[model samples]
Target: MNALEKLKILGESAKYDLCNYVSPNLETYASGKIPGVYNSTSPDGHCMPLFKVLMTNKCSNDCKYCMNHSNRKFERYEYEPAELSRVFMDYYNKRYVEGLFLSSGVFKDIDSSMEKQVEVARILRDYGYDGYIHLKILPGTSYDLIKRAMSLADRVSVNIEAATPDGFEELTTTKNFKTDILKRMKWISRLSNDKNMAPSGQTTQFIVGAADESDEDILKRTNWLLDKFKIKRSYFSAFTPLENTPLENYESPHPKRTSRLYQADFLLSYYGFSFDELVFDENGNIETEVDPKYSFAMNNMDLFPVEVNEASYDELIRVPGIGMVSAERIITLRKRGLKIGKLEDLKNLGVAVKRAEPFVKLNKSYQSVLSF
Candidate 1:
């Protein structure tokens, strides 16, 4: 197949490796006028068009949930490093995308696969295309190649498909959880000690529900990654079974599972929440109907009706509807000697009043009844 045809397949295959926490309701790609262009959301909530595609769809690894699994019988293809760099420049010159996100399956060996991707980044850099680039570090990639990739790209990641050893064993027999994945992540962390390597930092992803792992299991792993690697972020992709694969008959998790994971992840990453502070059901899964922060508030009603004007930044962020931005606004206005004496004042500052009402007091006057 030609480069464009290969991109259509490889690009679709790359979608399973998410770079950000995108909601299901949002469109992830451009309106089909062009192929390989993806609407990737940034950490700060800005959407930038990225030329996201795989270098190849041929694989030697047997990741059961993957469409490009080694056992799958289908047309396979790969792009020459220079060919992909040229195509990306075509998109870049036209202003169609702001950056490039390159990933690949293990075509022959892990290092060879990583080399092809790094070569593409190298070609782009050689051509003076100094824009954003994110390269996927294939599991088991050599430490030196990872350091080289870090030098060329702004961000890099490895998909830690499952949380535990046994859980990983259930997914694929061809890869090792600790040696192939975690050890490589450690190398990325260590190599990252130099400020010039992947300044945007490293990230990782997990396949939700494929290993029969619970939400609690996923969050614990995320917490561990944050503490150990100080990773820039973690992404959760809800498992969707595909045809003719080993997991073809397996059921997909509720869509809300990944969404709830993102919400809870934000709380852990930004809202000053500890894993033990989170509320979970008997099954160790977060609530699908109610968001995690709201559930936390509802579970501990004793902390409700906190005086907004008097609450500390930490305390204000824990409130159900008050986010980091709004909490900062409250503190900023408070320092200016402005008192939030009414619900409308909180609303003007971007607080979700309906959600925050029951949990906050305006100038010590309770705002809403505890209907629950």
Candidate 2:
């Protein structure tokens, strides 16, 4: 097949490797007029168009849920390092995409496979096409190759498909969780401390609901990853069974499960909440109906009705409906001798008044009655 035809298949294959984090759901690609062009959002919520495509679909590993699993039957293709570099440059010159996100299945051994991906980045950098590039650091990739990839690309990632070793074994038997995944993550973390290597830092992803793991299981790993590796983000891809694969008949998770996981993740990463602060059901899963913050407030009612005028920044943020920015605004206003006298005044500062009413008192006046 020609390059364009190969791009169509490879681009579709690369969709599951998320590069953007959108709320309630993960949307990696925008509605582009052409193939391989995706809209990657930044931390500041700016939309940056990216060329996301895989190097090849050929694999030596057996990931049961993957479309390109080694045992699966389908057409497979790959791009020579220079070939992909040219394709990306063509798109870059046309302004079709502002960045490149390159990933691939293991066409051969791990190091050789990783080498091909690194070569593409090397080619791009040598050609003076430096804007944004995110390269996938395949599991078990050698430390030297990892360093080379990081030196060229702005960001890199390793997919921690399962939270625990047994859960990982359930998904793929060929790879070792501790040796292949966690060790590589540690290498990236250590390498990332250098300012010149992967300046945007590293990220990771988890496949939710595929294995017999709970939301708590995922969050526990997330907490560890954030603290241990200081990863930029942890993306959760809800497992969808593909036809002709081992998981084809397996049931998929409710979309809300992944959505709620993202909400809880934010609380741990952005909001000042530990894993213990989150409210989970008896089964160790987060309640899908209510957000984690609201659930925490409802469960611990005694902490409610905190006086907005007197509450510290931490306490104000813990109140339901008060965000980091809103809490900061409250503190700033109070420091200026401007007390929050009414619910309307809090709303004007971006507080979700309905959610906050039961939890907050404005200038010594309780706004609403608390009820279970």
Ten consecutive residues with minimal summed lDDT in candidate 2?
23-32
Judging by lDDT against the true structure, name the best candidate.
Answer: 2
The whole-model C-alpha lDDT of candidate 2 against the native structure comes to 0.90
For residue 84, model 1's alpha carbon misses the true position, in angstroms, by 0.7
TM-score per candidate: 0.97, 0.97
Whole-model Cα lDDT of every candidate shown, in order:
0.89, 0.90
Candidate 2 lDDT over residue span 125-162, tens digit each? 89988799999999999999999999999999999999
- Tens-place lDDT digits, model 1, residues 1-372: 777877787777777777653443353765356788888777678888889999998999998998998999999889989999999998899999999999998887888889999999999999999999999999999989999999999999988989888899999999999999899899999888998999998989888889978899999999999999988888888888999889999999998988899899889998889999888999999999999999998888888779999999999999988999999999999999989888889999999999999998877788887733
